[model samples]
Target: MNILPLIVLFPLLGALILAFNPRLPNRLAALVGVGSIGLSALVMVWLNWLFYLGDGGGFTQTLWQWVTVGDFRMGFTLYLDGLSLTMISVITGVGFLIHLFASWYMEKDLEGAPGYARFFAYMNLFVFSMLLLVLGDNLLLLYLGWEGVGLCSYLLIGYYYQSEYNAWCAFKAFIVTRIGDVFLAIGLFLLFTRFGTLDIQQLLQQAPQVWQEGDLMAEVAALMLLGGALGKSAQLPLHTWLADAMAGPTPVSALIHAATMVTAGVYLIARTHTIFELAPFTLSLVALIGLLTLLVAGFTALAQTDIKRVLAYSTMSQIGYMFLALGVQAWDVAIFHLMIHAFFKALLFLTSGSVIIACHHEQNIFKMGGLWRSLKLPYACFLIGGAALSALPLVTAGFYSKDEILWLTFDHGYSLLWLGALLGALLTSIYTFRMIFIVFHGREQIHPHAGRGIAHHLPLLALALLSTFVGGMIHPPLANVLPAGPEGQYGHLIRVLTEVLAAVVALVGVGIAAALFLGRRRLIGNLMEAKEGDRLRRFFYSGFAFDWLYERITVRPFLFIARLHRRDWVNSLVNMWPALALGLNDLLLGTQNGRLRWYAAVMTGGAVSMLFLLLLF
Candidate 1:
């Protein structure tokens, strides 16, 4: 059965129903919300079964001709392939779990059932938009989904509209991502102008025929697309918004960080690997940005007190690894990491939600301690998720995925980039365990309630299991779908050595975190209070002051311009021409006083003057 359309439609239908009927009871709204995503997930499972049974290639289902102009036509089509199928599975499967969790999380929201319904509506809409983003056959349709998600993010991020900070965070996320969308739109225009087709498959096939490797136009187009990816993925320079996005609910954080908005860039790059390959320089730059972003965000994560902000930075850092994979031409590896990340990261966030609830919404790790006894379920889940996140050797999924990227980087002979990745891995371990120790090992500050429903723990348990075992199992199937990278020419000894070294680095980081946070707490606390340490902490905590830099460079100048034109100086200039015309009319009004004598005298003078001049000639 052609269930692709159903996958996209289910969530949208649910959203529409909820939107039109705002008075839905909490139970009904939760049912509709969870049911829609669950149905979509079911459809995706069927589609995957069909995909495996059939030829493992692309299948396009056209809904209609969406646009036409002379020789140009764009179809509202859904393309099913291994890559998109993987993405859809992640979206719907993980999305449904999140929805289920949200059902419990938002049951007692301040706005009650109406708010619950509204949250689900936006959530469903977001799912629909993301599905559209991944499944669209043409760039135009993909862009529509792109903008759709942005809108939904704005709505959902500020769901608690009463809080000015949440509203600002929503606006910040919207505006920051829009900057990337602009680049993506421009890239699409270039693609159409050069190839005359917006269909992704067609464009990929045509690009090689038309453009040679390293062609300037191809490079420019690739760069533009990279800008979009960078923004969407929360790479360096465009990453500040994500930290603020934690102002939203925990589920929103999970959705954006793990399965949806942030991962869009990785999917886009993987989808258009052909374009990136044509521009090798851009690919190299992708690697560089990934390296820098991962290191930067890792340090930032270390300084964060807020549990969500730490995860936010960690998400950015994790995506940096994916970018690094793409840079090294490990396309399959990138997707593998993406899938693994979605599992653990979502689990981590949801677990954090449970912790937050237990602690009465307290998000500071310093304020949380010795919760392992009280919040046993969440503590265990968090530990599992954190282990996966830190890529703890052969036991977790992240190790397989992340180690693949590192191996690929080394085999490709980019030792410096590989070293940077190693450092990122180390830092990731440090921060992940640091959080685990602080939040679950210290003295308990508050007594948290232990009445979370099955909806909460079930998703946590499912995701925790995935985070533990899914990595090794996914590689074989994922390999079939993605373009294969060249095998390393290195010896078995070298390969084994690299793997061992990577594991050691991760272990070392864990050791350091355990010592600092668990063993020598007073020493670390003293250092944190020291003048130099305090300054350093502030630096990393502020994301290396990128926000301050942007404010001074981008935001301040714009604000200044806005203030300068507060009275609409340009509008005044526009109005000046009309004012000048009116002033001239006023000056000349005396000469045209509607008097017949004045007209007759003027005509007589002109006639006499003409006659005299004619006689002189």
Candidate 2:
């Protein structure tokens, strides 16, 4: 009945086995990599069935007490609930599909057999770390998983360690996330100090009793947690690393962008909603940050030439919607969006991977043209994923989830926030269709072929189907399972009108993209070559110059200080004592000459001097 440990252990076991057995053949490694996640997914399915049949309340399974000092105790435990179950379902299910896709994607790594096995090893480890992050019962264990994902991301992102650019991107992802981890650690310490327990359920219960609404301590703690979420979720200022993260393999991009790294922040906020609720100011700040991030990332996506970078920014923007939902006290809606985003985003990235492979690993969209006939499966998959991403009316799952967030924003009286979200929706549709048109509409640039075998196409088909229809099926169940938020007292007519309005905005965006990219490609190209247009492109393309600004403000100053202290004055000062001792030794060397007469003379002189002193006394 306690199948929770198996969910995490399966992937961890596979990672260890693959890692230690470096001699594994490519075939065997692929089997192990894909099998491990598949088994985990199966176990999760079984657990879901059991959870539904049993009591609806959450359950915690403690493996052992991991740390103890006097009254304090921390356990290595797994927590199961509707929220975590949803997360693990996505992690294991979608993660398995990614693993399967990677088995094919990395089949012919330039590094050959060793590199192939190593890639799967890191992927399995990433799944394990992500599983632990969602299922952790205590803050300490969650932090362990938090840092674990960060490590796995660094390893996987730098999969091609030979490339300096890849290595730099990996380091950027690691270092930036670590900055957020520090805040999360501090928040954990604060929580433990306040309540003397790291157990999440107990902390949630105690938080309300000890801290009143808007309390300063509560606000600070909430903000620290928000900082962690910001970094992990790729929100606004901490978001630069994600676009660069496309330096990794396509599957790595899919995993990070869709199921694992970026979604962590949304989960963190949902899990700790109680803390955020206590800090009303922090909650408002969350909404504000989400609004800014969604719009900023949406525009950045428009300017990206690389296929994967566009999806990367889209992931950031989608996660922003989740944050916005949380900000408005729409907890269930946030999780709903997270789930829907995972499906379509993963599909989009995987489809892009197929395109990259078909085009001989070319990622620049401009370099790619009409492939609809040559690569039918990828084209279809891309269309479905793009439609879902654009929230195209009632046909795609994103429409339900995204429209709910937009409606809630307005219903809650945050009209400006709602307007920003509407603008973001329009932008999302534009970029989604824009990329679609650029890649699939123009004349064929190269003959394309679908990736070989069922491993490649099966996941894409499955995810594509989910992206189109999963929203309607999951909504009612998710509503039943998640904690409910306030529903505005709007009539059926008003609700219908809101949905209509959202759909129209999305359609208008798509229409504009179609007309500009599909109908008037030459004119757009000419405009792109214009001086003002070039300047505008560069601004958005560089993530609104945040990276450059950070370089000037943070990176350059730090580098200068490092160079200034390269000689290390403190080290020089420390060496001075030893240098003085050596000098004194040299000065005394003549007195220690290996001669008995010299020693006797020195002794006699000392004795004479002592007698002279006695006479004088």
Candidate 3:
């Protein structure tokens, strides 16, 4: 039997068992949940080994035919290639780690409603959906996984249903992403009509032959598909939901928002590279959009006070970089960066979770000061994750992947895009380190009743080790995996120089942040006391009112319009028609009153009148 099916089935079984047995003890449910994902991880590793050994080739396992109609057919097939392998490894690997961390992190919450079993059920379902997403061979199958994930996200986001804000956040995320889904559905229909098939591999094979560069249909398909990608990946115009998604559990934050769910958009683009390549205009648009999002989100991160919100915006900004990579056809490079991002980003969120648990759920970085001594493991892990985010030159995983993306932008002659990305990177460094400095480098802020236990620190220690060294280790193989362009069409020296420039920008950003927030505290303090400084601080702190602008310009007005149309003349017209019909029926039936004498007399008169009228005609 192929190991592929088990990868998805194990999680499905786990979800089923946990959902039915919600009354089980928390420890037992936790054991079942983590064990199931761990088993899946081992199977993925085994499959990887088999794939590597099979004549240096890829593998695909088909369970059965999904559907068939004349010339069109779809199958429940799993395709294992370099790309899918990367995603699976991240899903199961980082996913398992997060699951282990969640066990301890959420133990306290099991005392309330929606106990351990329910939490694990959502987590397991998430694993299964993500697996289906990466393994799917066709677009429709992929959509199934896509919708599955959206459902799981809603469940997890509203896990704490007692909080009205959590439910609202879940609804917001659901509605925002549905906007992208509409475009994606249209794109799939267009692709099927044009190519006569939804199989991604086959579509890729035919796209280059059938569609030339600048083909209108290809461009439309790319744009429509990008609409979905932008929303899922938290790009511009559809990115607000991510900041609010922080209302979910901390492990959910680390697993879904940080590592897996957001990366699905990047994977979609990479998986359908041929379509984008044939649509040059669409690709350029993607790059432009990515650049805008990177700059906007990076700057916004600087203003955030909540630790998770800071990381939330950072996720958006980093994903923008990935989209930029995909737009430039750096498929392997984008996936590589995604892999590295998963390690460090998950580590950061987990460490933050530890810090929050230790401090009894305090999340404001301003409220947290010198925690290095009290929370040594979290401090060390946070530093490791922060270093990666700052792209500390050649030492961090982010440096390897993100630097390559910067290099690609310049080498492709996108000078303005490169400059924008550079600025974004600088802002990323400053904001990332700003949080780090505030939370760990200042005066102690731990409360007296806050709990500190071994359960909280172990995950931090494990993730910290991975965050520190994974980037450098992955670099050698990652470089080889990236596609090399045709000679003379590519610019090698420019690539290297651009990497160096990105590194320099990151360093400078870090330096400036250190000087203001750490190195020259008195100077910054004095500046803060000045009236103008207060205004400037408030401006940045409120994210320059981007969220407010969105509400005023888009969300609030759209809702108002919906309410007006739904309640005004149209609704009245519908009600009036129904009421009018009822009145007409009553008037026509009113003559048949149940009085015997009146009824007999009216019948006799009507019969005589009818006889006279017929005789006259």
Order of quality (lDDT): 1, 2, 3
Which residue runs does candidate 1 get wrong by more than 4 Å?
109-113, 476-481, 567-570, 573-617
- Quote model 2's TM-score: 0.92
lDDT tens readout by residue for model 2, 261-378 = 7899888988888899899999999999999999999999999999999999999999999999999988888988898898999999999999988898888998888888788899
lDDT of 3 by residue, 1-617 (tens): 27789989989899999999999888899888988999999998897777667654456788999898887778899887777877888899889889988988898545455578999999999999999998998999898998888899989988987899999999999998889888899999999999899999899889989988899999999998998887788888888788999999999999999999999998888888789888989888888888888888887788788999999989988899988887777667788788888989999998888888777789999898878777777777877898898888866777877887887776766778878889999999999888988888777766513335555666566666666656447531223223543232356676667777888899998888888787437887898799998888787666667778988998899999998788688789889989999999998798778889988998899999999999999
| TM per prediction | 0.92, 0.92, 0.88
lDDT of each: 0.89, 0.88, 0.84
- Please give, for residues 314-370, the per-residue lDDT of candidate 1 as tens digits: 999999999999998899889989999999999999999888887888999999889
Q: Candidate 1 overall Cα lDDT vs. reference? A: 0.89
Per candidate, the number of residue pairs that clash is 1, 0, 2
Q: Considering summed lDDT, which 10 consecutive residues are worst modelled in model 1? A: 472-481
What is the TM-score (0 to 1) of candidate 1? 0.92
lDDT for residue 365 in candidate 3, whole number 0-100? 90
Question: What CA RMSD would you report for each candidate?
Answer: 7.9, 5.9, 6.0
Clashing pairs in 1: 370-442
Model 3 off-target regions past 4 Å?
109-114, 448-458, 475-497, 526-536, 566-617
